[model samples]
Target chain A: EAGVAQSPRYKIIEKRQSVAFWCNPISGHATLYWYQQILGQGPKLLIQFQNNGVVDDSQLPKDRFSAERLKGVDSTLKIQPAKLEDSAVYLCASSYGPDRGTDTQYFGPGTRLTVL
Target chain B: AQRVTQPEKLLSVFKGAPVELKCNYSYSGSPELFWYVQYSRQRLQLLLRHISRESIKGFTADLNKGETSFHLKKPFAQEEDSAMYYCALSRSNYQLIWGAGTKLIIKP
Candidate 1:
């Protein structure tokens, strides 16, 4: 079976620029999540979506970062006016559903972003 | 708030030696724990979960709720065992709260 897929495996941008990352989740999965992993740190969730509806986004920087799961299958995370501190790996993952909360989450090869 | 910790930044052991990666968590409720691994050039993937209580690739982790720890252990480490390991905790059965991962290097 195909795993989660992400575009532009690596990205480079300047501070204050805008950057976007895309994600295509596993087929039939109903839960999608976006996480940011800084160097030497674990992945921290930025947002979560269940069938196009946001489930959580408490950690997201609302002033600059935004994410959307359009049509409930693909997702895009965007950071406007990016900062040097925003340099990190953007990981996308999918799960069967919220009811299967602890079910394994399939992850995509993350997009490594560097802000100069 | 839920938090996970992996105290070691790096761990090195000779091939065929025993390996143990430490993990600790802080949560008020019954927590579900998981170990995720990332091999070079590979995406992070689930290695095991505490609820399953199963071993994979000869690595096993036992959750000690009393100590608030879930340490990954392998009796005989192999070169292939070298990778980045993360310990995560899910509070209230929701999305995971992850630890800063440990880099494992098994030298031959």
Candidate 2:
């Protein structure tokens, strides 16, 4: 079975520029998530979606970061006015269900964003 | 607030030596725990979950609710065992709270 897929494995943008990352989750998966991994740190959850509705986004930077999963199959995470601190790997993950005991998340290759 | 902590940033051991990666979590209620590994140039993948009580690639972890710790361990480390390991706690909605990863190096 194919795993989660992400576009533009690497990206570079100047500070204050806008950048967007796309993710296509595994087939039949019901939950999708976006995470930011800074160097030498674990991935931090940015937002989570169950189908087309958001489940949690408390950690998301509402001032500049936004994410959406319109059809429940694909998702996009956007960061406007990027800052140097935003340079990190953007990972997309998906799970077959929303139950912690029964579902394990599968991660994508991730997009490495470098802000100049 | 839920959180996971991996105290070690890097660990090195000779092949055939025992290896342990420490993980501690802070949560009031019972939370599912997991260990994830990422090999060089590979995506992050689940190594093991506390609920399954299964070993993967000679690695095993036991959840100690009394100590709030779930440390990954292997009796004898292999060169191929070198990788980045992360401990995570699963929330009710299936969202993961990850620890700062530990990089293991098994030397010959």
Candidate 3:
């Protein structure tokens, strides 16, 4: 129904600054994902959470990027000391369960971050 | 590692013409494939998945395991079909791998 929800549809920060994004998954969704989509490129998975426990974070930049899905419903992605290269659209998606891997992933409008 | 590829960056066709959006994937295991679409100013949404063997919005894709391809096609294209399409592949435990995506423009 309501689909995933994201806050601050757009954000701008200077290089070396910090930024954070918020996302709320659909009700009853047990799996949530964060992805980065640069212009002209496909969305790349950053992290995945299965009810507050991380299922995957292989691509996340531990040095400066981190994400947490506390309480298993809402998630927040933070980037400390943002780099110009970090400028991209941050997308959040959620699914009912892991068993439904082929099921549709409801996506939010995404947070467009611009690092100057 | 699994990979998805959308060879064409852009495809243009006139209204009422046949349309095809090619998608090729490489994976070690029996892969699951999906097609996602994003219209202007809209969030990306799933178009269809190969496992279901179904069609949506007049678009259908047939999985060819031998060819390692899952090309989306429609008998006739409409102007409203214009959008960005991405092909994705998922393995056993990993997340979906996506292609660069193709922008389909249906000319009026």
Q: How many residue pairs clash per model?
A: 0, 0, 0
lDDT of 1 by residue, B5-105 (tens): 99999999999999999999999988889999999999999999989999999999999989999999999999999999999987553688999999999
User: What tens-digit string does per-residue lDDT give for candidate 1 at A18-81?
Assistant: 9999999999899999999999899999998988999899999999999999899999999998
True contacts kept of each: 0.85, 0.88, 0.76
Off by over 4 Å in 3: A99-102
For all predicted structures, in order, the TM-scores are 0.97, 0.97, 0.97
Model 3 C-alpha lDDT per residue in residues A47-85, reported as the tens digit of each score: 989899999999999999999989999999999989999
Off by over 4 Å in 2: A99-101
lDDT of each: 0.94, 0.94, 0.93
Better of 1 and 2 by DockQ: 2
Off by over 4 Å in 1: A100-102
Across B18-65, the per-residue lDDT of candidate 2 in tens digits comes to 999999999877889999999999999999999999999999999999
Question: Every prediction's TM-score for the first chain?
Answer: 0.96, 0.96, 0.96
User: What's the chain B TM-score of candidate 2?
Assistant: 0.98
Model 1 pairs whose backbones collide: none
Superposition-based RMSD of candidate 3 using all C-alpha atoms, in angstroms: 1.1
Q: Which ten residues in a row have the lowest lDDT in candidate 3 chain B?
A: B88-97
Model 3 error, position B93 (Å):
2.2
lDDT of candidate 2? 0.94
